[model samples]
Structure formats: structure tokens, C-alpha cells
Target: MERILMSLQYNGAAYQGFQIQHDLKTVQRELERITQRMHQQFVRIHPASRTDKGVHALEQFIHFDSHLTLPEDKWMHAFNSALPNDIVVTRVNKVDDQFHCRYDTIGKMYRYRVYTNPLRDPLKVNLMTHMPYDLNITDMQKAARLFEGTHDFTSFCSAKTEIDRKVRTIYLSKVIETTYGFDFVIVGDGFLYNMVRIIVNFLTDIAQGFREVDDVHKVIEARDRTKAHKTAPSEGLYLERTFYSEDELKHCVAELNTL
Candidate 1:
């Protein structure tokens, strides 16, 4: 048997989440169903993260062991043929048995998009969250700078998470005005449940004059969820990338350092 790793790009609107739940549609369940059909046997697939409902991913990683000796390209063609149109396996490769899809991951990049236009676009309702008020991008960017480096993100996370540590490194959190809307890119070592949403809400609040920009420090120091910003809508969030090798990631960091 060979352990194969597959990177998936999925539109999470129709699925419940990544994990399997009774009677609920999930990316993993669909992929597993296809894999089982391809092999004519039951197969278990493991994913790096169980993203919440309505949250999309540009690059999500999953690994599974297959006794069938199929080429990397065939995995995508065969698996996607049986799967739904929204989910696609973009890449597949055979990896070491010791390599875990989740644990071995060093960090992930997520983008939360918000439409700050005066009028909402009908097509973007399912994709981007629309906020009519003009946002102060400068203030928001300044507030986002506070999230950089190592910090205890307990206040920003959702309630009742089981993670032992709340400290996470935020490599970059920038607010950029894109052609369509405002984009918030947060690249971090790891994230807590609803952390990105909460952060975005806080920064957006600061931009909207609902909260003071300096209040971010107060919330961080308090370590209370209520002290932080409210959790934004989940539909705007997308996991953009997940880094695997520490060496590869280090090279990325070094490249970024020179920039």
C-alpha cells in the first residue's frame, strides 16, 4: 500500500464541512466515496483542517493510503469523475508513510474578502460579504499590524476550543483594496476557531468608526472573547494555502525577508 497526498480545491457552500457527519455533505465524505469506488474497497481519507460550513479553500490538503497503483494524474481524473463538480483534486502525489497531512503542516494562509461598495453585487452574495459603509482602510491596516508576530489569540477565537495553546505567529495581516473589494490576507502559523473572522470584524470595526484602533491591544491583553471583535460572517473566508515542508517554508520566508 502507498500513502498518497492530494491537494483539493473546494467550494464549501454546498458541503457541511470537511469532516464526515451523519447525513451531511462533506468534502472528505465525497472524496472518500469516490476513492472507495475507484478501489472497490473502503478507504479512509485524512485532511489537514476541518473548515467550517460556507468557508471555501483554494488549496486544502488530504492524504489517504491506496493499495491501487494509479498514477498521480489518474487520481484526479478518476476521483473527480465520481465527485461533485464543486470539489476538484488539483494535485496528487505519493509521500512517506510518516508524513501526516495535518501535523506536518507548518502554517496556512487565509483571505477574507469584503465588498465595501455602495451597492451590493447580486453574484457576490454567496462569495463575498457586503458592507455598505465606507471603511477607513488606513486605520484598519494600522490595527492589523498589532496582530503581527507571536501573540496569544485567545480573545479572537471561538468559544470552547480544545487547543492547548493560544499563541500563534501572524506573519502577515494586510488590508489591500482590490479591484472588486477589500481583501484581508492573514498568513499565520496556525489559527484558532473563528480567529480570522474575529480579527477581521475587529479591524473592520475600527475602520468603520465603531471601535478605536488602539482598542486591539486592550482586547489582546484581556484575553476575553467578548473584549475582542465580533465574528464576521463565514462566507467571506477562504483558506488560500497550506505549507508542508519546513525547508520550503523557510525558503519562502527568506524570500519574503529580502523583499
Candidate 2:
């Protein structure tokens, strides 16, 4: 069997989530179905990240073992031919058996798009979260910087999450203003369920004068879920990139800034 890693991009509006569920559409389910059809046998895929419903991905990673002997260059086109229009395989690479998509990931970068316009744009309804109220972008940007270090993000994750540890290190966090909205980028060693969404909500609340600028520090120290703001909508969130090393992450940031 040959092990392969593939990068994918998908619009998450229609699917339940990335994982498989009975009688529901999902990215992994569709991928496996197509792969099984091609291989004429059951196939399993390992995804690097499990994105929530309505959460899109600019670049997602996965690895799978397959007996099919197709050339690496043809895998992307072959997979895209059978996959749904919303999901597409961008790149494929053959790797040693020891390589794992999830375990080998060193960090991940997520971006949240917020529309700050007074009127909602119909074109962007599925992709961007509409926030029609006035906001202090400066304060929000400042608050984002406060999250740029290691902290126990217990207050910023969903209470339903069963994970024992809530500690994660933030490598980078910044909010940049765009023509119609703001883009919040966060790079972290790891994340808890709904962590990014909750952090965005907290920053927005601070910008809207509903919370103090220093509340981020207080909530991190409190480790109380109730101390944080509500989780933001999933549609605005996108898995921008994943990094396998610190150097790769720095290179990605440099490349992204030029775009």
C-alpha cells in the first residue's frame, strides 16, 4: 500500500461536517465513497482537522493508505473528477508510511471574516458574518494581541467539549481591516472546540463596548466558560493553513502577506 497526503479546499455550507455521520453528507464520507469506488474496496481517510458545520476551509490536509498505483500527479484530477463541486483536492503527494496528517501538524492558522458594513451584502451571506453595528476596530485589534501567548483557554472553548486539557499556545493573533470588514487571523499550536469562535466573539464584544479591553486576561485567568462571550457564527471562519514546522509557518505568513 502507498501512503499519500492531499490538500483540499471546500465550501462547508451544505455538509454536516468533515466527519462521517449516518444518513448525512460529510467531506470525509464523500471522499471515502469516491475513493472506494476508484479502488473497488473500502477506503478510510484521516483528516488533519475536523471543521464544524458551515465552516469553510481554504486549505485542509488529509492522508490515506491506498493500494491503487495511480501516479501522484494524477491523483488530484482523479479525485476532483468524482468529488462534489464544493470539495476539491488541490494537491497530492506520496509519502512514507510513517507520515500522519494530524499528528505531524505543528500548528494551524484560522481566519475569521467579519462584515462591518451597515448593510448586508447578499453575495457574501454564505461566506462572511454580517455585523451591522458600529465597532471600535482599534480596540478589537488591541484585544487580539493579548491572545498572543500561551494560556489556558478554558473560557474560550465550548462547554460540551470533553477534553481534559484546555491549555494552548498562541503563536500569532491579529485583526486586519479590509474594505468592507475585518479579517482576524490566529495561528496556534492547538485549539479546543469552538475556541476561535469564542475568541472572536469576545473581541467583537470588546469592540462594541459590551466588554472591557482587559477582559481577555481576566477570562483566561478565570478559566470559566461563562466569563467569555458567546461563540461566533461558523460561516465566517476558515481554516487558512496548517504548518508542520516553525519555519514553514513563517514562510506561509510571508507568502500570504504578498497576496
Show model 2 residue runs off by greater than 4 Å.
253-259
Give all candidate RMSDs, comma-separated.
2.0, 1.6
The residue-level lDDT of candidate 2 at 146 comes to 96
lDDT of 1 by residue, 1-259 (tens): 8999989898888888889998788888898888788889989999998898889999999999989899888887887787788988888899999999999899988889998779989899768989889889989988987888888988999886888799999887778778876888887889999899999999988998999989888889898877874789888999988998776655655554443
Candidate 1, residue 117: the lDDT equals 75
Judged by lDDT against the true structure, how good is candidate 2? 0.91
Error of 1 at 215 (Å): 1.3
lDDT, each prediction: 0.86, 0.91
Scored against the true structure, residue 113 in model 2 reaches a CA lDDT of 95
Candidate 1, run of 10 with poorest lDDT: 250-259
Could you estimate the TM-score for every candidate? 0.94, 0.96
- Per-residue lDDT for 1-259 in model 2, tens only? 9998999999999988899989799999989998898889988999999999999998899999988899987898889898989998989999999999999999999999999778889999779999999899999989998998899999999999998998999878888899988999998898899999999999999999999989889999999998884899999999999888789898766664554
